[model samples]
Target: MLQIAVIGAGVFGKNHIRIYRELPGVHLAAVVDPAVTLEDTPVFASVDELLASGIPIDCASVCVPTVAHAQVASQLLRAGIDCLIEKPFAASLAEADQVLALAGQYGRIVQIGHLERFNPAVTATMPILTKPMFFESHRLSVFTPRSLDVDVVLDLMIHDLDIVLTMVNAPVTEVRAVGLPVLSPKVDIANVRLEFATGCVANFTASRVSTERVRKLRYFQPRQYVSLDFARQDLLVIDVADPAAAIAAFTQGAGLQHPSAGLSLRKLPVENGEPLKLEIESFLTSVQTRQEPRVTGQQGRAALELALEINQMIAQHAERAGLL
Candidate 1:
C-alpha cells in the first residue's frame, strides 16, 4: 500500500485526513499539524518533525493555508514525496512554478485540488460539451470569514476558470474583470469575462457576500444549450434548432415549446456523489501509474495566474473608485 501523510488539520485538512484514512490501497502514515493535536493517529507538530522521523511516506496531501502552500509543498517535493496541494496552489504564480519545477526535477507527481473537475454533474456533461460558443458561471457563497485573506477571484472563481479552460480548449485572447470589497478588506465580489481564440467566451461572477450559495454553469452551443447546477446536482439540456416533428413532439410531451413560446429548456439528471472522493481517487491513480494528474501543477499555475490578474483588475477598479 502507498503510504501517505496529511499536513494541516484545519477544516479542509480534516476532510483530507478522513479521505486518506479510508481510501483503499493507501496507508495514512501520519498527521502533521502545528495547530491541532491529531488524537486519532500519530501526530507531528510540523512537517519537519514527520520528515525528520524517517517515516516511509510516498505522497502527502498539502492542505495548509494558501500562503503556506509553497513552502510546505516545496519541502515535500524536495524530499521525494509526491503531493496533492489544495486549490490556488500557492499565494503567487512564481511560488507555484517553484513547486512544479521541483516535482519535475525529482520525478514526483503533483496534483492540484480543483475538486469541481470531479463533480458528477461536470463529468456527466463532459461528453455532450461540443464546441461551446459561450459559457457563463456563477459561484456565490454566504459570508464566510475563512478566505478573507484573498479576493473572491482566487477563493471562488478559480474553480470555474479551471473548468472553462478544460472545456474551451483554446488560448485566452483577452480578459476583462471588475470587483469590489463590500464585506471584507479584500475583494469579496468579482466578475470576469474571458475571450478565447476559438471564438468561445466565458463570463464568470463570484461573490462571498451573498445570502445564499449558488454554483452554476451555462453553456451555449450550436444546436443546444447546457446548464448545470452544481449545488442541486442537476443538468439541463435544451435543443435550440428543433426542426423535426419528432423534436416538436418530444418537446410538447415534456411541456416544452418550439423555442417561440419560451419553453425550450430540458432537464438532464446527474447522479449524486462526493466530488472530493473522486478527486482523491484520481490522485491515487496518478500516483500508482506514474502518470500526470488530470489537474496538474502547471494547470493550477495557469488558473492562479489568471486569478491574480483578475485580482489586480479589481484592485485597480477599487482604487479608481476611492474604495481602497
Candidate 2:
C-alpha cells in the first residue's frame, strides 16, 4: 500500500486526509499540523518532525498556507517524497520555481490541486472543443476566513484561469482587471478580461463576498456554444446544424416549426465523482507509474504567473482610483 501524509490540518488539508484514508490501497500515514490532532493518525508539529519520524511515507499532500508551500514542499521533495500541492502553487513565481526545480531534481511527480480540472463537467467538455473564441466565467462564494492570505484572484479565480489557459492554449496578449477589498484586507471581488494571441477573449469574475455560491463557465466556438456548471457537474452544448439555415431563419423570421431551421441542444452525460477524490487518485496513479500528472508543476506555474499579473493589474487600478 502507498503511504501518504497530509501536511497542514486546515480546511483543504483535512479533506485530503479524509480522502486518503477512504481510498483503497493507500494508508493515511501521518499528518503534520501543530494546531490540530487526530485520533486515527499520528500528528507531527512540523515537516521537520514528520521527516525525523522516518515513517516510510511514499507521498504527501502539501496543503499548507501559500507562503509556506515552497518551504514545506521543498523539504518533502528533498526527502524523496512525491507531492500533491494545493492551488496557488506558491506565494511568488520564484518560490514556485523553487518547488518545480526540487521536484525535477528529485525525479518525483508533482501535481497541483487545481481541483476543478478533475470536475466531470470539464472532462466532458474537453473532447468537443473546437477553437473556443469567447469565454465567460463566474465563481463566487460566501465570505470565509479561509485562504485570506491571497486575493480573490488566487484563492478563487485561479481555478477558472487554469481551466481557460488549458483550453485556449494561446499566449495572453493583454490583461485588464479591477478589484476591491470587501470583507478582507485583500481583494475579495474582482473582474478580469484577457485577450489571447489567437483572437479569443475571456472575461472572468470571482468573488468571495457573495451571498450565494456559483461556479459556471460558458464559451462559444465557431458553430457551437458550450456551458459548464462546475458545482452541478453539468455540461450543455448547443450546435448549429447549418450556418446558412440559422442565418436564413434569423433573416426570414421563421417560426420554431420552420422545416429548414436546425438547432440541436444536448445535455452531455457526466460521470460525476468527488473531484478531490479523483484528483488524489490521479496523483497516486502518477506516483505509481512514474508518469507526469494531469496538472503538472509547469501548468500550475503558468496559472500562478497569470494570477500574479492580474493582481498587479488590480494594484495599478486601485492606485489610480486612490483606493490603495
TM-score of each: 0.92, 0.97
Instruction: Score each candidate by Cα lDDT.
Output: 0.87, 0.95
Q: In model 1, where do residues sit more than 4 Å from their true spots? A: 243-266
Q: What value does the lDDT take at residue 191 in candidate 2?
A: 99
Q: How close is candidate 1 to the true structure, as a TM-score?
A: 0.92
lDDT (Cα, tens digit) per residue for candidate 1, span 1-324: 999998887888889889988888898889888777765678899888998999999999998889999999998999999999999889987899899889989999999999999998999999888889899899999997786667788889999999999898888898888898788877788888999999998999999999999999999988788989987788989776544653556656644554343436666667888899899999999999999899999899988988887777777776788876
- What lDDT tens digits, residue by residue, belong to model 2 across residues 1-324? 999999998999989988998899999999999999789899999999999998999999999999999999999999999999999999999999999999999998899999999998999999999899999999999998999999999999999999999999999999999999998999999999999999999999999999999999999999899999999999999888887887788789985436666777789999999999999999999999999999999999999999999999999999999998
Q: C-alpha displacement of 80 in model 2, angstroms?
A: 0.3
